[model samples]
Structures are given as structure tokens and as C-alpha cells.
Target: MIRVHIARQFDVRAADGRRLNAEELHAEGERLMQSLLDLEQCNDDFCDSVTATDADKGTVLVELLISDETETGAFEKSRTIVRTAIHAIGGATPWEASADLGADYRPRDVQLEYV
Candidate 1:
């Protein structure tokens, strides 16, 4: 099994310059989770038991477990999948809008385990 920890940061705001409410943030997290789940279902090497958890500052941490039979470069493939999803939610260039790049919660601390 291969496991990876992925984190994505979200902003509490909409495109219209309005602050997002708690409900909206929660919805976004769920939306992201569903997107990941969708990806997992489409890949035979992906594990069925993926997990998503809401984190502080409108961020979500996802736990991805893949089967050992997956091909090489699995890490890069998984990273791209998540980065693309985050960019999609953030309008392709969310970091450009914020002076502090960290505000966008770019994915970080990718811990990989193979067993």
C-alpha cells in the first residue's frame, strides 16, 4: 500500500469580493473531497478508502491510499491530480491575487509511505 498526505488551503471569499460563510467553506471542502473521490474511482490502482478531513484556516487534508500495483511515478501523478483540483477551485491563479502566497494554502508536507 502507498499512502500520501495532501493539504490544500482555501480562502474564505468568493469571486465577487464577498466573505464566505462557514457553510460555504464547508461546502468547498466537501466539493474537493468529492472531486478526489471521483478521481479514485476512475483509477484501478487507487484505493477505495480515501479520507478527507477539514483543517484550520479553510484548509482540507486528504489521505490517499493506493494499491502497491500502481505504476512508477505515482507520487508525481497524485501531486498533479491534487494541484490541478486546487487550481480549479481557486480560479487558476489564486496566489497572484494574494500578496502572501501561503494564504492560498498550497499543498504541502507530502508524506509518502510504502509497505
Candidate 2:
């Protein structure tokens, strides 16, 4: 099995007198996750899972996990899928995401695990 991880963080401000809640964070995360899931035309089951964690610095961390067979082509396909997904959410230019980039997340630092 091969495991791929992708994470992104964003800082959101309260609109009106209400504060951002877990539900709202989840909705955004889900939307982003779907956009990512659509990549590679892999199966919907390949989505694995997505998580939105609240950060200490008032940031929202979105994590995506996708699993597939162990193969070089699969890895490259996953990389293409991940890169396109992140750029779409952040921006086409790398610098556009400098501010909202996840603290522990690096789009170029993808990890491949074989088991």
C-alpha cells in the first residue's frame, strides 16, 4: 500500500459577530477535499479521508489522505493530482500561498510510504 498526505492551513476571521466554528471549517475543508478528490480521475473511494483541525494561532489546518497501490506511476499521478489541487485552492503562483501556507505543510515535500 502507498500512503500520500497533503495539508494546508488558512486563517479565517469572524464575519459579523459570529466566530468561525468547526462546522464551517469542515465545510470548507470538504469543498477543498472534493476539488482534490476530483483530480487524477481516481475513484471516489480513493479520497480516503480529510480533516480540519483548529490551530493555536487561529488558523485552520486541512489534511487529506489518499491511498493506492505501490507503483511509480501511481506516485507521479498522485503528485500531479496533489499539486493541481493545492494550486487551485491557493493560487497558480507559488508566492500567492506564502501567507496561508500550512505551518507543517509543504506541497513540494510529498512523502511516499510503502507497506
TM-score of each model, paired residue for residue: 0.56, 0.41
Top-scoring candidate (lDDT): 1
lDDT scores for all predictions? 0.52, 0.49
- Going through the candidates in the order shown, the clash numbers are 0, 0
| lDDT at 70, model 2 | 52
Clashing pairs in 2: none
Candidate 2, residues 21-84, lDDT tens digits: the string is 6665555456557666565365542455353546334444545555666556556555555456
Give per-residue CA lDDT, model 1, range 54-106, as digits (tens).
43454455556555434346666666666555555553334345542222434
Residue 44 lDDT (model 2): 45
